[model samples]
Target: MKDRLFEKPLEKQFEFDEEVAAVFDDMIERSVPFYRQNLDLIVTLLLRFLKPGMRVVDLGSSTGLLLIELARRCGVEVEFIGIDNAPAMVELARKKSRALEADVTFLCEDLMRYDFGGADVVVANYTLQFIRPAVRGKTVQKIYDALKEGGLFVCSEKVLMEDKWLNKQIIDIYYDYKKGQGYSETEIMRKREALENVLIPYTIEENRSMMKEAGFSAVDTLFQWGNFATMVARKRGK
Candidate 1:
């Protein structure tokens, strides 16, 4: 289904509701820059670090697309768990997983409160920005604490530039990119307004600092395009 969610007038703030979930796959692919390529980069990085029987968790795993792909390609025995607060997304993800016969568990739960146990790799693809800034630091700290020694936390986020003029230019470029993806100007504006306060983003440097403060020994960008970036943070020690 195409993403026509914003074509109609929105009565409430943007959310991962049933209506949004219905077309989330389309929405993500079109709205996000280098969506597929980012996922591929994540998989590639995970492949290098994942070991047989290790645990992998995806925070805010809407639609379970990444988990399904990982389950198919990882080949090695590993536990794949997807956590999403949206019940609609969780159901759709589970249905898709069953249809594909992929061994992945999709849980409808709050990521902040969920006990991650100890995972070899934890991924948060465009997830952290939605969290309130006040609690975002504590959330990253929790993710770090949930990782096993030498584990990794890979995250992708929509970032902002520190330079106001540069940020505006990049945003215009991004809007143009959306237009090229077949989204109408109205749709773009509507969605942007709907997500105004709901999706708060951080600067790339701010994101890196948060991870470092959370005790990640090293942090590096894996891919970047305009205002979007994927980064990896490694937990030190064997």
Candidate 2:
């Protein structure tokens, strides 16, 4: 389905409900700049890091697209689990994966409370920002705890900049990008209002600091465009 969700007057705040689940792939690709490139980088990086029999956990795994793609490209030896709090998202993800025969499990569970188990890799693409600011640190710690020694925590987020002028300029540029993606000005503003308090962001430095504080030995950014960035944080080896 095409993304006309915001074209009409929004009845409620933005959420990962059935309506969003149906066109999630279309919506995300259009909304996030360089998202496809980010996913490609993630897949490539995982291929280098993944070993047979390894377990990969995805948090906030809306629609399970990334895991499904990875499962197809990386073979069935590596286990893939995608967790989402939204039932609609999980259901659609399961349906799609089953239709494609992709070896990925879709679980409807709150990512904050879900156990990642002893996994080789954990991913949280465009996820952490939705978490409450107070609990983000604890969540990162859980991710750190779930990783085996030398394991990686791969994440992407809509970050902020400290410089007010630069930040405003980036946001303006992002709005322009959305317009280019076919979102009318009214649709953009409506969606923004819907997400006003729901989608929160942090600075790149703050994200790195939080990850390091959560016991990740090293954190490095893999990609960034406007306000969005993908980063990798490594748990220390024994």
| Candidate with best lDDT | 1
Worst 10 residues of 2 by lDDT: 108-117
Q: Candidate 2 on 23-71: residue-level lDDT in tens?
A: 8899999999988888998998898888899999999999988999899
The lDDT, on a scale of 0 to 1, for candidate 1 is 0.94
lDDT of 1 by residue, 1-238 (tens): 9989888887989999999999999999999988998898788778877789899999999999999998988869999999999999999999999999999999999988889978989999989999999999999999999999899899999999999999999999999999999999999999999999999999999999999999999999999999999999999976
* Clashing residue pairs found in predicted model 2: none
Model 2, residue 58: distance off in Å is: 0.3
Runs of candidate 1 with Cα error greater than 4 angstroms are: none
What's model 1's lDDT at 238?
A: 65
- State, as a TM-score between 0 and 1, how close model 2 is to the true structure: 0.98
